[model samples]
Target: MVDSSKTHEPLLVARGITRLFGNAYALSDASIALCRHEICGLLGANGAGKSTLSRIVCGHLPASSGEILFKGAPLTAGSARDALRSGIALVAQETSLAPDMSVLENIFLPSYALPGRLSFSQLRHKARAILSELGHDHALPLDIEVRRLSTAQRQLVEIAKALALNADLVIFDEPTASLSPLEVDRLFDIMGRLKSSGKALAFVSHRLEEVFAITDRVTILREGKTVAEGVPTAGLTQADVIRHMVGRDIGNVYRKAVSPAVTNEQAVALEVTGLHAPPIVRDVSFTVRKGEILGLGGLVGAGRSESAEAIFGLRHRSGGRVLVGGKEIAPNSPIAAIRAGLGMVAEDRRTQNIVPDMTVGENLFLAQMGKHRGFGRGHSARRKQAHELISRLGLPTDRMDANLLHFSGGMQQKVVIARWLLIEPEVLILDEPTKGVDIGTRQTIYELLREVAERGIAVVVISSDFEELLGLCERIVVVSDGYTIADLPTSRLSEESLTLLAAPRSSAERNAAFLRDLVAGHGGTAFWGLIDEDRFVCLAVAESARSAPMGLAAGHVYLAHETAIPLALGRRQPGHVTESDGRSTVLTPLSNRRGHDLGWIGLSLPAGSKLPNAETLSARVAGLFDTPQDEKIDA
Candidate 1:
C-alpha cells in the first residue's frame, strides 16, 4: 500500500555495507533502502547479519566497507551521537539503558543532544505523553529504577526513548518480542500513525505474522548477504520469507508425532502447589510428568519467571510447596534444588546464566558443579557428557575454549541450555529460552527440547511469546497477574483464545460482570470467549440459578460436538439461531477501534426459554468495550 516508486525520496539508504570483526565478516554486501511513510521489515535467521546492518545504519557500529546515505548526506559511522543529532534512532534489541536511572530520565536521555536548557518538569510531562501514546501511560512509574522493571517494561522504555527523539527515521529491533498480543497491536497502531505522518521506520523481528501485519516492504538477509531487497510485502507469503531466510523449505516448525501428547500417566517430575512468592507469584499450582514439555505462559511481569525462580529455589517462597520426584525440597536453597534433580535457566541469560570471562566449556559445565560433590568443579568428570551434549546441540566442540560472550545470541542460548542438560536433571526449566533467537535457531532449539523430553526430562519453558508456547509446548498453564488461571491442552487453544485467557484481571472482571448482567436479564448461560471450528474456549461465564448449562466453563476449552448448542455455534450468526435440540444461541464479535478481533460474547437459551433479542444482545456487547465497535460474526 506504500508508494515505493521513485517519486518519493528515500529517507535512508545503505548499499553494499560490510562489517568485519577480526577475520570473520558479520555482514557482507548488505543493501537496503527506506522511504518516508513506509515501514520496511528486515528479516533473517540468526547469524544472518540483520543486527549488524541495523547497528551500522544507526551509527552504533561502523562498516569496514561501503557507505550509508541519510537524507541525501553521508552518515558518520560509529557515531551514535551524530546519528541522534541527525534524527535517526535505534530501539536496540538488547536494551541500551542506564539501569540505575529512573524511567522518566531514561526517556529523555536523548534530550541532552538539544542546545536548549533542560526542564525536568517539562520532560516528565512529555514522557507521560509518549507512554500514553504507547497505551502504557501508568504501567511504568517515573521514579522506579530501570533495573527493577520487567523485560517488557524495559523494552517500553527503549521505545519511549526513541519516540522522544521525534526522529525522521526510526529503526525498531524486535520491538514486539516481549509484548503481548494486545500490546503488539497497540505498537503497530503507533507505527501506522508514524508512517502516516511521513516518517520512515524499519522493523526487525523474527515474527513473520507481525511483519506481514505492519510492514509494506521486506528486505531479507541470509548468511551476511542480502538475498532480497525492497520487495513489497504484499507479493510474498510466509513460506517465501522462510525459504529466503534459511534457503530451504522449512515446513511445520512443530512436527511432533501425531500420537497423543498426554504424558499424564508418567511419573510426576515436578509439582508446585499453592506457590506464593508474595506480590509477583501467588497461588501457582501445576504438575509436570516425566517427558512432558509443559509451558508456563503469560504476559511479562505476570509472575512466570518469579514462579520458576521460586520453584527452583532461586527466590524465597513466602508460602508454597515445591516437589521434585515426589520429594518436597527446602525453600531458598538452589543447591538443594540442583541435588534434587532440578535445573533452571533464568530469564536474563547474560546476568544469570553466562559468565563473560569464562570459557564456553566452563560455562557449559556450570550446572554440573552444583550437582556434584565439589572437590573437582565437575568439568573433568562430565567431559564425555559435555562433548556429547555439545555435539547433539550442533555446537562446535573446538570452540569450547573460546569466550562464551563471543558467540552469537542464539549460540549463547544454546550453550546455556546445553549447560543444564549436561547435569541430566529430571526437571529442566528454561525461561524464554528462545527470546532473541531467530527462526532457524528457533526451529533447532524446538527440536532439541523435544529430544530432551524424549529422554524423559520434564521441560518447563516460560515464554512471553504465545506462538512459541503453542508450538513447542504440549500443555500451557496460563498465568495472569500472578495466579495460575488456566491449564489447557495446546490442541484446544488458538492464539486469540489464549490472549483472552491471559488478559489482565481488570478487563476480565469487567467482562465477568457484563456476562452476569446479561444472564440476569435473559436468565440463560452467558459467556465471553472464542470459538474455533472444532473447539470452543471460555474466557468468562455467568449463569442464572435456573439457567441451562451450555457445557462450558471459564478458562476451559471444549469440543463443539461435545456441547448441546453445536448447531448454534456452527452458525455463529449475528442473530439468534436455534439448534436441532431447540436450544437458542446468539454471538456478537468483539473487536477494538482499530479492528483487532478481541473474541466473541455469546448468550445461549434453554430449549423452551424465551430467547433474548439478537440486536439488543449485540448492542450490549458493543457497549462493553470502551470504544463502540461495529460487531460482525467472524465466519
Candidate 2:
C-alpha cells in the first residue's frame, strides 16, 4: 500500500545503527529512513531500541556504530545543540523543560544557547504563534512557571518548544500518552499541517492505534534488531504489528482469562474509607477482596496515586480509615501498614522503589529489611524465598551481584515486584507498573500478577492506561476531581465509557446541569450512560424528589432485565416508550463534533406527568456537545 513515488527519496537516513550500554547492545544494526512530507512511525516494545535510535539521531547520546545522513550529507552531531543547529529537534517522553522557568523562557531556552542577542518580547510573540498553530493558544499562558502545569500541559509546552526551533525533522516520543481525545485530535491536526509543509516527522509511541491513524509507514524493532522496515501502515493490521513487536501473535494481552475466581465470600484484604490528603486525595473509598485485582483509573492529577500513597502511609492523611485483614491500622504510619500486611510499588520506580547504589540482590531484599524487627539487614530470613522468586521471574542468579541500574527497565520493575512478594503481604498495590515497559514484558508482568492473585494476595493496580486496566483488573474504581465517582466490573466498561466517567468534575458540570434541568422541568429522573448489548453502564444520574423512583443510581452497572424499565433501555428509540408500570422513558444518542460516540442520555417519567417533545429533548442533549469551549457551563 506504499506510494511508490513517495518512497523514492528520504530526508534523513540511518543505516546499521548500533548503541551499547555497558555489556549489552541497546540497539543492533537498526536502520530507518524518514521522507519529506511523511510521518514515519518508530514502533517497538520497551528496550527494543526505538528510544536508542531517536536519542542517537537527536544527539542526546552518541551511537556506538552507525552511519547517519541528513539531506544526503554525512551528519555527526557532537551534542544536542549541534542537532538543533542542523534543523532537528526531539520532544522527549520525559520532558526536558526547566521547572523554575516560565513557559515563554523554556520554549526559547534552546535559542539562548546560540550566540545571539535575545529579545523577550519577540520570543513571547513567536511562542504564542507556535501554540496557536497547535490549537492550544488559550490553554497555556506565557508567564506561568513550568512546574505548576499538569503533565498534559507540560507536554504542550514541549511541542511548542520544538516548533519554535523551526526544525525540518521533529521526533515525538509518546507525545499523546497524557492527552485527552480532544487534545489528541488537535495534535493530529498540527501534524497534518507539518506534513503539508514538507517537513519529515518521526513518531515514537507504544499506542498502536495512534500509529495507524497518523503514520504513512512504520519500522518495527524487536530484540534490538529491525524486524520490519518501511512497512506501509495502510496494509498492516493490529495483529500483524503485535506479532512483529513481540515476536509472536499475542492473544488478549491482558490475560484476563488466567485470573482466579474472586467471590464476596472472600475476605477483604484492604479497605480504605473517607481517605483524605489535602490538595490531591479527598474522600476516596474502595475495598479489594482477597485474590482480586482492583484498578484505580482516572485522568492525570485525579489523585489515584495520591489515594494509594495515603493508604500506604506514604502521604499524611487528614482523615481516613485503612483496614488490612479486617483490622484497622494507625493512620499515616507506614510501619503499621506494613505490619498489617500491606505492600506498595510506587509510581516512580527509579526514585521511590529502587536503591541504585545497592546490588540487585540487596535491592530485592530492601522491603523485607524494613519490616524486620531484629535489625542487622535480616536478609537471611528470606534468602531462600528470594532465590525462588528470582528464578521464577527469569532473572539470572549469576547477575545478582551487578548494580541494579545495569539491568533493563523491565528487569528493574520485576525486581521491585519481587521485593514486595518476598514479604508475602496479604495486599499489594502497584502504581503505573508497566510504564516504560515493553509489550512482551507487560504480558509477563500480567501473568506474574495473576499468579500472585491466585495465591490469595489482593492486588491493586493504578494506571493511566485504561485499556490495560480494563484487561487486567476484575473491577475498576473511577476517581474524578479527588473523589471515588464510580466502581464497576471490568466486563461492563470500555475505554470510551471510562473516559466519560473520568472527566474532570469541572468539565462535566455542563452535562450535570443539563440533567438537573431535565429532571426539574419534566418531573422525572434523567441519567447519562453507555449501552452495550444487554448491559448499561450508568455514568451520572439526577432525580427530582417529587419524581417516582427508577431504581437506578450513579456509578452502577445493570442488565437490561434487571432495571424497572427494561423495555425502554433495550429499544433505545428516539421517542418515548411506555412500560407496564405506566412510566415513560426516552433515550437520545450523544456525540461530539468529530462524531465520536459519547453515549446516550435518558429520561424516565411517571405516567401522569406530561412528557417533553422527543425532538426538543434530543436537541437539548445535542446542544451540550456542540457548545463552544469558552462558553461551557461552569460548576
For model 1, the superposed segments whose C-alpha errors exceed 4 Å read: 1-7, 258-260, 546-551, 578-586, 605-611, 626-635
Question: How much is 42 displaced in model 2, in angstroms?
Answer: 2.0
Number of the predicted model whose TM-score against the real structure is largest: 1
Q: lDDT tens string, model 2, 1-635?
A: 12233574898999899999987999998988989899999888777888889989999999999899999998889899999999999988768999999999999989989997998888888887788666566557899899877665778899888978889999998787666454566689888888889999999877777899999999898878888888889989989888888878877676555344799999998889999998778889999999999999887667888888889888899998888998999878888888789999987666678989999998998888778887487788788888889888878888989999887677898999999999999999999888667667788889889988999999999887888898899999999889999998898888877877787776667777788998888878998888878888777789999866787877778999999779988997788889998988888897766566777888888887778888998888877756556222211
**Over 4 Å off in model 2, which ranges?**
1-8, 99-108, 114-166, 176-197, 257-260, 625-627, 630-635
Cα lDDT of model 1 by residue, 1-635, tens digit: 12244335888889889999899898989988999999999998888998889988888888999978988988875588888888889999889999999999899887876798998998899998888777676567899999988777899999999998989999999888778776787788789999999999999999888999999999999889999888889889999999999889878877875544655678999989999997788789999999899998887577898899898888789998999999999998999999999998887777788999999988888888778894778677679888888887778999989998778788899999988888889999998888778777888888988988988899999887888899889899999888988998898887878887887665467668888888888888988878788787877888889865766778788887888777766776678888887888888887655566777788888888887777887777667655422211111
- TM per candidate: 0.93, 0.89
In candidate 2 the C-alpha lDDT for residue 332 amounts to 86
